[model samples]
Target: MTSAPNDLAFLRRLRPLAARELRLALLAGAVAGVMVVLQAWWVATILDRALVGREPLAELVLPFVLLFGIVALRAASTFAAERLGFAAAMRVVPALRRALLGKLGRVGPSGAAALPTGEIVAALSDGVRAVEPFFSRYLPATAQAAMLPVGIFLVVAPLDWLSALVFLVTAPLIPLFMVLIGKGAEALNQRQWLRLQRMSGHFLDAVQGLASIKAFGAGPRMVAEVGATAERYRRDTMAVLRIAFLSSLTLEFFSTVAIAIIAVLIGFRLLWGELDYRAGLFILLLAPEFYGPLRMMGTAYHARMEALGAASRLVALDALPEPVLASGTARPAFGDGIAIRFEDVHLTYPDGRIALRGVTFAIEPGETVAFAGPSGAGKSSIQALLLGFVGPTSGRILIDGHPLETLDPEHWRRHLGFMPQRPKLFAASVRGNIAPGEADPDDSAILRAAERAGVAGVIADLPQGLDTAIGNGGRQLSGGQASRIALARLFCRDAPLALLDEPTAHLDDDSEAMIHAAITQLKGRRTLLVNAHRPASLALAHRIIRIEEGRIAVGQAEPAETACPC
Candidate 1:
């Protein structure tokens, strides 16, 4: 398919990453084309001398040896071209993956603008892989198609201008018809990619929520739904393949017909004694060679369509609104806990949903503060601002007497221990989950953290203790168990500033007590901000900040003995 201008431009932007390898591949392909001409000339000359001139085998020995060498060199050049093309594609794929992943990372914990998890996965894995063939095969073949046929015609024109005329006349038809057939295939390919992405998203969602489906006894319905998505994907894939086969057939038909026409003409002229036998045979040999690159181009054209379909998604992902990170040079000192103050902070999401409105509060260093609010009352919004996920639409936050906007986010985050309401666990051993990024954390340290989070008993009951592998998102564990594991991970971090969003959410009373004990022990050693709903959890705070409708209804220090009234 003819690529859209933006698709082509996107490809051009990535070309420089592997420019040297791509140039070498093109050089190798050109050498192979030159060898094809020389090989044909040698074969025609040897045949003419040995058969028509009745030359001795001994006299033709040098030419035979030279022809063999040409064939060997041609094969070697072709191999080099293939290897170099693959090398270029390999280099380009990693760079593209890195760029895509970095873009995703910048989206932060707030979510990738509501991008589907499956779509993100497909783009990073399947989409990036799809681009490989465009660089490796389609691009080099296109370059060869543009030059090789013309070079062959230049060589043949001197010997037989009619054959050169045939080559010139029929060459444009290959790409003309290729485009005609490819236009239909391009749409099919695009649809196929889109269907695949939807299918991936559906399947991922189904798997993640399998427990709910099972509880509702909707397994059969989910199965049917997933099957329908798979079937649609299969049909679209087959349709794309059908177009590919048709395009290949069209190319072969045109090239074969063109070669046949040249053959018939050369045979007739030779029989009429109007052409020399060697020249006639030479033109005949070069005819197929003239169409070879064009045929190769036709075969690699499907890869181009696939890459474009994938690239459209990738380019769109890159075009997604990314959070503009603060370019602050100042680094805040969090050694003795962090003093945070929000001075009339306001936060509005991209979708025009205001999460915070004129919210203002302050927390002293090493103080334990709790934000009490119903869901969507800007409690988590305050935590989001503190985490630097998104900058305030208007107003400022101060960190240790310094404007929060002036502190480097990456540096500021390094000292933070955050636990979101729906905590995520990696597919790793229980030990690994407790101490993420630590290759071989101290078992005693892991034990201490687990004990603090109250998951020590749960770990002991596991078949393999801390070495048990929790599947993706802790599928092997219950929600409460996973939440406790996340809490343990927070304790393991031991950062000076801890932000726990509903740390006791979705937990049993027993599990809640374990975590409460952990937080109580952690108090006065770090700056703590928690979004708490249960009265028992709010009681642990030295101060309770009540929020309602994005405004602070009350910000008062409540003695532990006093009950908090929401």
Candidate 2:
């Protein structure tokens, strides 16, 4: 999107909170204006009474009381406005986060392929966080500043037209200068945020690949890359700061000049006997008071720009299209069987790369099929399409004569279990990771799944059994153990259609053989699609599909089943 359109969309989205917050902010300005006018009028009244030789002690007491009341009321209104504004600001954050997350989910791995994980994290965290000031403080302050000046002009008009005119003419300069200075600040702020996201992405990449770097004796190179990214980020940050300071200085300079001009006019009028001493004093005092809020708003304008820059990125992410839900479709029921058929299917990546072409295949219910191919031969792509991660570019995939697109992805997935090459493990107890949420599988069921996955012995030997804590990503477990734990999770899921992607790729011969036995037991009862190149995995398949150049060449089983070690 072009910069102008992006900004308009962002502002439009924020209009609701902006309007609500502005109203509350104007209330604050009203209180501030009342306080200033009452203070000036009280002082003028007291001076007038004294000069006229009339002592009204009760009148003096009333001014003091009014002064105290205004101050207390202004303070209370400010506190309430801030509290309510902050609450409103916080309320929008979750909705924004959900919108962004939902978009990412629809985009999936293919859409996110080019986007770095760390950058997305930065946008989700720091970018969304920046909107807080815009919603809570800067936005309200801007409104209050704007209304306060106008209110002051109305109060002064009855007392002195010249003073009110001077005030009105000069007030516009403050915001004008603020906008002129802040024009470039928004662009600079955006650059700074982008640099920070790049730095975060680089750091996360370095950390994830640290093991490989150390193995290849490239640790120093990775460290140098990280250092370079950090330096670049620091430079961008300093650039933003420099622009912000200059903007603030320029706004302050203009406001000071305007206030100085007003003061000079009031002083000269009093000296030339054109105005009363008491009136001149009041105008002089009110001159600075009138510009105070504007000056504050000019200074806070940078904060608003910074917030806008950050919010723009978040808005972009949230605006991305989300997945469309199936309409008026009943949940598919796969009863101990599933048949998948791909008819002349084709898939092209977003970047125009074709991953699959004219692929045709079929899997019978209660049959085990394995896809074997070299890297980038469409094995993973086909699996992804089957799982609804990406739709086919042409042709169609069907399950039981129903088009895959017509089925609810979530409901379809519930009957399917997937174990990728690298399975994710959350930091939690073994049972919690195995069962996930509150679907309390009995102890026997848990043990049975673990046994089928060949991990029952390992869990049984642990001091806590199924209750043992698995560190983040199952870091505490060995590769084979982690794979077994993931398999155990799959068995616990017990979906009728299973998609196993190289489930035993990294395991030793003993573990692989044990898992093969488990697979043998699962066949002829559940529909299975295994993506594998290992011999042990191939031995378990009733049929093997060979993929090459985005097309399936052979999809029939051998005359006899390959024997496996008992």
Candidate 3:
């Protein structure tokens, strides 16, 4: 394929996935195209019989019934084509979303952060919806426009070659104008998608930061800024509307001119006794219908352009290289006591922010270590590297004396139970939260873990107890309750290494009692890597390693302010 074809190949790539619906839609459209022809022919015959043939009304019943039947077929085909088109479009959107999300996972967590969360949400939701018109309207319309116009012209040709010649000449003008003008609309549509990305990002930011804005008494100012941005968006939108209107005006002008020229030619021919009234009238009716599909395509044309813009964006997103993942066994045993070491690691984010720089550390077997650092000190980056979300820009991370990259990340993670700073509770019950996504999770063990975490009593008080729905993201639970439940999951999970980050953050006094129990239970059997923010959490670790600006500051096992020992 040439460069032009290659660039837009993403649209073609979706064809097979939606072939079923598109075929149905195409069939409906083709049938509708033929129906319009039959409907027009029957109308012409009925009119000719009544007026020109001077036939009786009673004799016309069958003709009228046939015309109605043809009209009914046209309407049915129209509805079926529309319904099928929409169904195809609906299927593609979610399929696109799933494919995009799967791609995001393969890109890994760090690379996926290249786009803001709000932009991802918008692209997956509204941005994908913008392309809906292509499948639901444009594709079917294009098929109909392609087939119907030719059918009309062929039918019109034998009746009156002069009129067919007029159609032949006029037909190309609609798409011609559409293409020339639509080029501008296509550029505007791509810009519109970007603008939508910005709009969605800012709106999400505003919503998320509303509390801060209110507290700082800057709510009005923020609202004004959002309003100004919205106004700019509105102006951009109106500019697209102006082009559409101009294109519509151009199309209407040409269609009318084409029909007028045909009408004048037919009149002159009829007056000269060369053409019959029935044929002239049939040609008149057929002229608009001939132009009709092309006009429909013209109207639906922008939808195709908009979908193209979306496809272009999707192509760019897919162009991101897949994160290389090691293919290794998932059941790697931890019997040798999993050891972790970071040597001169460095990480620079896609936006050029450096999160890690020459960081070095090591954890021996059965060691309980705490990574003590302030926010943005590359604490999470170390964990991210170990988990293989990303590799170091320069340096290495070793697990069990082997390079971390050589081990399958999923398999490595399967051997470690981690609770990050933010606890994620699902829309399930207390027992469900205690053991999510485990192979054959034990209910009794879940309750035992919950008891150790000091939140089992709280769950027992709920109307449905362990089976009670926690609601989405555990909205029904307090922060302390949520934290305890997460800790419970760590307790119940049978991983050899437990990686817990600030696990006690949102706990109450009562919840802390359970934290102590869970901590004691986690002490010696499993190797523990903890990101601690409090003295109590820090005390659970055998050694404390402080990180500052991606470099190790001090180690509890060594002299104060000593460099990290790799």
lDDT for every model?
Answer: 0.87, 0.77, 0.80
| Model 3 lDDT tens row, 1-566 | 11225435877777777899999999998998888877777787888889888999999998888888889999999999999999998888888888888777767778777777766777777767876788899989889888988888788888888788888888899999999999999888777777777888899999988889899999889889889878887887898889999998999999999999998999999899998887888788888888888888998998877777667667666665554343444344566357888888888876688998888877887778888889888878777766666667888777777676666667787777778777899988777788887667788898888888888888889998888998877889888788878888888876777788777776766666667667777777778888867767776777778888878885424422342332
lDDT (tens digit, per residue) of candidate 2 on 1-566:
22746754675586574466556656765676777777776677677676654777765787677767876876787677777667657766666677677678766666656466886888788887877777676766777786777777887788789878877787787788788878777787878888888888888988888889889999998889889988988988888788878867776777678778877887788779888877777777777778877877876777788777787677666654332222215477788879999999998886789999999988899989888878889999988886767788888888877788888777887788888998888998889877776466577878889998888988988879988988889987888888888888888888888999988887899878877787777788899899888877887788788889899875333411553221
Candidate 1 lDDT tens digits, 1-566: 22467876787789999999999999999999999989988998999998899999999888888889999999999999999999999999999999988776666657476677788889899999999999999989998898789888999998888998999899999998888988898788788888988999999999989899999999999999999999999999999999999999999999999999999999999999999999999899989988989999998988988888888888777776654444566875677588888889888997789998997888899999988889999998888777777778888888889887777777887789998888889988999998888866999989999988888999999989999998878988887788889988888888899999988888889878877887887799999998989988888888788888899885334654475556
Q: Candidate 3, which segments miss by more than 4 Å at Cα?
A: 1-7, 309-322, 326-346, 354-366, 372-377, 394-414, 425-433, 436-443, 461-480, 504-516, 533-535, 543-566
Candidate 3, poorest ten consecutive residues by summed lDDT: 556-565
For each candidate, what TM-score against the reference? 0.94, 0.90, 0.85
Ranking of predictions according to TM-score: 1, 2, 3
Best by TM-score: 1
- Candidate 2's error at 103, in angstroms? 2.0
Please tell me which model should have the higher TM-score, number 1 or number 2.
Answer: 1
Question: Which segments of candidate 2 are over 4 A away from where they belong?
Answer: 1-4, 14-36, 39-59, 276-282, 319-330, 437-444, 554-566
Q: What are the clashing pairs of model 2?
A: none
Index of the highest-lDDT prediction: 1
